[model samples]
Target: MPAPFTADTVTVHSPATSANLGPGYDSFGLALSRYDRVRARVRSAGLNVRVSGAGADELALDEAHLVVRAMRAAFDRIGAQPPGLELDCHNDIPHGRGMGSSAAAIVSGIELARSLSDDGRARLSDAEALALATELEGHPDNVAACLLGGLSISWLADGRGAAARAATAEQLAATGIRPVLFIPAEQSATRAARALLPEQVPHADAAFNAGRAGLLVLALTSRPDLLLTATEDRLHQGYRAAAMPASAALITALRSRGMAAVISGAGSSVLALALADQAGAAAELTPVGWECARLEVSSGARTSGA
Candidate 1:
């Protein structure tokens, strides 16, 4: 049997996602137009991972590389040894700006593995693909939006742990929600951001965030006009503001500017008002030193590589 990867290299383009929609935290996410185009070609020589575009030249190309690790994980799942392959990544998303670079790499690797699997083609079902990606990315927020495409709302099942570090094998099978998200440039390590918390929060603030997270879903499916009121937050945003004070500040600015902006996921990015009427003009906010893009709420969050 010929190796699937041994054939002409397969290529894929994955979109990035913004998570935690202001107050929704972990549960809300939206897909964007930005992408990382991945081309995988099995080579007769040793494994070679080539990166191009955006921050490609600045990336590391070794075994511990995220792309390589993800590809290896996919092959291992199918009980097959990965063939040496040349991977070229046109990275359009910033490395650690809270976009979905990690998600794109994981999705690209999973797609490569599926493209090179035993049945000569062991593609993953959308749900299966989402599950595996969530496992690698450590949460469904970015993976679900990247794999499924669009604004999605996903949460741990009845009493599951935090979405960031939760064992998402089963949790990935859960449902998703929609949101308006933003990404800012004021960045920090997720762990470091998480470390700033005082461990306990006033029950009032906790309740405030919980109620808004719930409203985030309703604002999308039920009444979008209510989002201004629904997407408000108290817990994650306030705590993270210590590290990303600019995130909250910017959201306020956008709101005053008539844009419904919110902090994206953990920090450093902002998800601003995006809808049919506002989507086009939204890109104008490409502030100096900030890469702004017009993101949409789609169902399958994917784009053509070309």
Candidate 2:
């Protein structure tokens, strides 16, 4: 039997995320302070969606909307689809700028659906929620961070998504590191950026990345001083640099000044893991047209009004 929804309305806030932080490749992720908020209400009859901020002009307001699609998937798992839905999305995350905008939308939808059902939480454990989100997003990194928050390391176990937070909320606060993003006005598609990589990398490069990835975890948690060295990569960044030259140049410039910077996710936006003292300088290095923001490491998604 389908689980009946216990609530008429639910709201969820999902944070933006950056994945593949330096050498961690498809494993590392960090949630940012910015977020997208979605409020969904069960209705008696059809679908209604309203959008504002960021992708307001481009996003669909129908069943084709990513959030709606995610809700549909979750409802299917719960064995009941609402007769109708009303969704209002207020977004802060920029679309296609290498921030996990899509992941935020997907997570928000799933969380909202869970919040609406009487037994949704029981039916969808945290692991099950992560697995479903990963199936929808096609990777675990960004979605993991969006769900679990702070710094998360995610991987597949038996072909299902699994993740753990590397630092507690308190531990992350004590690190005194801020995430500074340099976002270009232009956008880069994840697919297009991915197409630039060679199918095979040299064994030497692979070995080099493994060592740095290990060091990166240590640096992010307890040793901010090692970040400049720890964030070095021999994997994806260099190969995709040509497609986002400005981002590539900015990262190089920031690193030369002793800051740890990398391409955020696929391309276009650059992320600098900056200590309190370095945050301002990191922002100053942003190119004329790019947007810069200094953000704290964020907590995971939250739902209310179920």
Candidate 3:
């Protein structure tokens, strides 16, 4: 008879992530339509990796890769050597495009580790798994939205994920939120984008962001009708504009069209939209310098096709 689970492989699906949700800066984020895949199967006693898709041409599918690093760390947590392994990947999310491609890999890799702990099965509590995954991914924005689906408000401590302080799927579900993604043919280096900002902002700028930040939460939660009012940002967007070649043009175009958009995390990809009816035609605009993809916001990042 064939074994019920002979493969001894754990295939984890991770959704693509968009961090720094326009006004949220380090505080806000959303999952997106893109994705990547990771399949881990056990072998005798060595490690092997394979890669294909979006970033494959540039990414290392070996020990030096970020996913590999997270997997190894998970093994260390369990105090065991992961059996020889095969990791097959498909990278739908482009690298360095301000999308959470790397974070998804980290979360998927951690799931692989957790599976190894349960004698090759995944049995970690959702909360525990969430915390562990966030630690491996560094920060809660991407990991939180991916794990729980929908909108998540999480806190991280010492590089570990805290239980969601609050989750907003209920609120987000009450109304529809569509996303307009201006994916340029060119990708932005997250690190370079970060380098564009000053280590500190003037007090006035910081204070102004605080007020809008509050409005952002309210708009997303209790009153999405105010999304237009809520989308205004003070902290990261304007500052990042100087560095991101495409920022100003995209934001202006989106607003002129009555769409709500903000930099979806230190980005070149400007995520925005008005309503579902508008999304279809809006996607067709494709400004002179950008490639646009418009998708209504789903509760969480997508993984079925990853």
Give the number of the best model, judged by lDDT. Answer: 2
CA lDDT of 43 in candidate 2?
79
Tens-place lDDT digits, model 3, residues 1-306: 122123455666676666666556665666665667787766766677888988777878678777778777776655565556678887877776777777788777766766655432334555666676777666777777776655556676766776452435445646666667777777787777777787888899777767776777777666666776677776777877877756667787777777777777667777774566667766776677676776534455332221
List, residue by residue over 43-106, the lDDT tens digit for candidate 1: 6667777787766666778777677788887777666765466777788777667777788888
- Clash totals, every prediction: 17, 0, 2
Q: Write the per-residue lDDT of candidate 2 for residues 176-230, one digit (tens) a residue.
A: 8889998899989999988888999999999999999999989989998999999
What shift in Å separates residue 272 of candidate 3 from its native position after superposition? 0.6
RMSD (Cα, Å) for all candidates, in order, is 5.7, 1.5, 3.5
Return the candidate ranking by lDDT, descending. Answer: 2, 3, 1
Candidate 1 Cα misplacement greater than 4 A, ranges: 4-6, 120-128, 156-187, 275-287, 298-306
Winner by TM-score = 2
What are the runs in model 3 whose C-alpha is more than 4 Å off? 1-7, 119-136, 163-174, 296-306
Tell me the TM-score of model 3: 0.86
Q: What TM-score, to 2 decimals, does candidate 2 have?
A: 0.98
